[model samples]
Target: MKIEHPAPMQWQFSRRAEQLQSSVIREILKVTMRPEITSFAGGLPSPATFPVERMREAFDAVLSRQGSVALQYGPSDGYAPLREWVADHLSTDGVRILPEQVLMTSGSQQALDLLAKVLIDQGSKVLVETPSYLGALQAFSVYEPEFVSVPTDDGGLLPETVAPIAQGARLLYALPNFQNPTGRTLSVERRLALVETCARLGLPLIEDDPYGALSYRGEPLPKMLGMNPHGVIYMGSFSKVLTPGIRLGYVVAPVPLVRKLEQAKQAADLHTSQLTQMVVHEVVKDGFLTQHIPTIRALYADRCQVMLSAMDEFFPKSATWTRPEGGMFIWVTLPKHIDSMKLLEEAIAQHVAFVPGTSFYANVPETNTLRLSFVTVPPERIRDGVEKLGRLIAAKA
Candidate 1:
């Protein structure tokens, strides 16, 4: 009684769609979701630091005061007061941030995507660190840019080597403060040199700094943008200190670039959420971050210390890891013979997990390296996980 039709054929797709690949960390996170596993895989902020009651108060206040406007459509650039707040917060003695130069985004990730849209063309050369943020690599790859990985050390990006590799490059993407996966902060001198060199070379610098505010030490370093405002696009986010749920971040750049980014943003999502922006503004209008950020610093420092001590006691002498002053991760380089990807299989069997270093690179990867996140796991659990991981490595070695 039913009419038969020809079988459906495979849908044709663009070449760009064919090149899209899944994030390795995202795939690893699925296995780590089990309660039994002690996961050091995700770059997630500790939930204990989230100001739940304060955010609730802000939401209620927004609804009570500007309910109609908060729910309606807004400008592609962002809400004015929120943009002004971002500008004021970032301005320093020598550097002045104009509100017109600030563009609010859904998150710092959206800023990366927007920059890629405006700056990258097919086969355009883009410079990056030898090992960089996986999320940035994923976002930039969609644009089909030819990536050139510049060598890095504990001090962060090498300014001297930059000039040689950066020729014919569209931009150099860097996370100078509390860098993801590495947890290293660039020295003030190096930052100044890098900024100066980039300015001279006419290469744009995109500074993605989400974890800069989470420094364990009370002191903060001068931003690279402060050195060369016209040459750099600085990105910041409310995700680390507050909560990622609100999905709030902003980019400060020169007026001309901001105009192009706004156009790209218009096509992306029209605008970031108006309600979220208004609520975040209400929550932090009276300088809430000034008090809130220090507490996060203290908590993370204690957790980091716990993980460091555990590594010292349990791990072998041959295994080396970075001792970060502040930030969420610890990079461990195991013995030359061991591959972290294979080690992860054993670690998961023993109910522990970490991100392999291979996922953070643009091209050839170091299989012996891995990244450990200390903030989310409790002290006792961290001790347990590190000990188990050390024993596995010791056996393999």
Candidate 2:
């Protein structure tokens, strides 16, 4: 067989695509899919919560009733009924949004991608919650924005730190409730302060709330969108409550931004899946989410207590971890001498693994930190995993 010679024509590509790298966690998951690895590394939810049998019903119904539309290409705007459903549900947050404002994304992660496409240009300034969602970081990175982190305390983001920085920033990506990594909810005081500060500065805010409904403790604080709807782009997902495999998520951006986001969506693969939208719509219409979410909360609450108790029993005094009220993750800060990336190698060697904190930061990672998730494993594995992690720390000490 003879190979065809290349057409030696000069070609160029978007500077952004040339700089991008595939997700690290996605690659790691392929290895962890093996039965032997007790992976604490993944952000996966518990399989017990995935309504596989119900999904089979959804698939059958969609095919039997709405086969062509379900399988064929959809409008760039997304399925209308599902958009209306999301808009109606969002009304509970005191947000007055129409179905037109909602863009169905493959997941909230893709919503981040669309926003980055619309908002970020080279050297554009982006600010994030310190140790914010790593997927958000990866999505925003393709545009090569200059990222700056704001310090957060137990109650979440410190507004005094953020007020001055909002000065000429293009975007503020906030995971205010039950934030990933830390699992801390922004206090009502900080939320209000953040809202006021950002709105005053005319900065575009991206409010990512994939973990809001999963809270097991504390009173719900008013959403940032409620405080100032005009300036915030709110991102939400069914990945936690319903199922992630469906890839259903949406973003409610403020008016002007919403228009551009739709154009960006057109370029980024047309739209989110129509069949998945119909399935989610069917389940949501049946009131399963309202009933299903509380069970998830209960299971996670019980698991959180078990993990916290295990942390108290096993973790060394030199190490400290966040006690998150609601959310899937807990961040741990190890002793200064411990580089989490180095320690992850040790952890994986013991048949246990976790994401190193280095990957989460936009600038330099606080090498002593790492995130541990409590929702994926059964409580017994969390206990055993924490014990193993503890033993490794002791050995290193």
Candidate 3:
């Protein structure tokens, strides 16, 4: 006798699941995987800069010297020596950081998610730059907070304008050094004022500085965390300098907040990979990045110049773009009549690609803006891709 089977149950998802959306940059990267496309859509560091030989040596050393410890389960907070290194690395003459305040994350991206889980609630007000980092917006969206866009210019976020709208905000997130989408750096004067303003108002500030060390001039800027360590939460990463495959990044915060984040992280992933942490500590323990980072600065600076020159020669007179002192991206603003989203379709057809500015916004988006990454592409290819994009914009303008 044949038995009748019941229909499969429809899955019920939480309200948080409803807020999920795929990353537009990651989606565009799929199309650019073809060898014929000269793509500037991903924020990937140049593979030429990765320390492959050093990493292989470090992995071999870790497994040979301390195989059991390297492979065993470690503390939820992180490896001890790595935490101490992060503390000492970030400490300055004006401010001191303790090892107890550091928490290791899978990457800085995971740190963003941990912060959202610890700080955000339904309808909590969060402030961000007018066109903020897309990853941050995506991470915070899952927690269901209301985002308010703060006005900005080439100099970066306006300090005076922050106080008026910051009344009920939970936190003010800013990338004061070589921001992600715009590559704009906040001036030292503005940094002081913004930190003082937040400190006076009793509001917390989140300082994300993944690109701070990439300055072309080799001059480092003062971080806001040094100004008010108790009030600001600082996030840093090794992805830009080392390789991203190891997936190592860190957070330095007040000890109390660090403990809270550690608890949240435990509930999420229990702990980061033990073997990866040991290998990274082994690689960076002896001042490897001191010599390595300058080479990256020089290479990126050269590529940036090549792309800028190509844009000047090829783009229409109505088009304008930022001349970044450092970092991988240059933000472009086309004529008001042109929409970069539509322009991207025409561009991909011509074997060139870029990220549209719409995904970078928290609320309202500027359709005429787009971001171009120059580090992964060679200098000659940079010129060709920029020229192709320029022709597309000129036709629309």
Score every model by TM-score: 0.98, 0.94, 0.98
Expressed as tens digits, the lDDT of each residue in 1-397 for candidate 3 is 8759978989898878977999999999999999999999999999999999999999999999999999999899999999999999999998889999999999999999999999999899999998899999999999999999999998889999999999989999999987889989999999999999999998889999989999999997899999999999999999999988889999999999999999999999999989999999999999999999999999999999999999999999999888888888899888888899999999999999999999999999999999999999999999999898888888888
Off by over 4 Å in 1: 1-6
Give the residue spans of candidate 2 off by over 4 A.
1-15
Off by over 4 Å in 3: 1-6
Q: Tell me how far the alpha carbon of residue 187 in candidate 2 is from the true structure, in angstroms, after superposition.
A: 1.1
Please give, for residues 72-125, the per-residue lDDT of candidate 1 as tens digits.
Answer: 999999999999999988888999999999999999999999999999999999
Residue 8's lDDT in candidate 2: 86
lDDT of 3 at 27: 98
lDDT of each: 0.93, 0.83, 0.94
User: Which residue pairs collide in model 2, if any?
Assistant: none
lDDT of 2 by residue, 1-397 (tens): 8769967887687777688887767776777787766777787888888878777888888889998988889977789998898888777645577888888899888899899998998789999988788889888898888998988777777888987776668899989988877888888888888888888888877889998888785345678887887888899999988888888889997667777888898988888888888888877877777778888888888888898999999989889888888878888889889888888878877777787777777786798988887787877888888899999987766
What TM-score does prediction 2 earn?
0.94
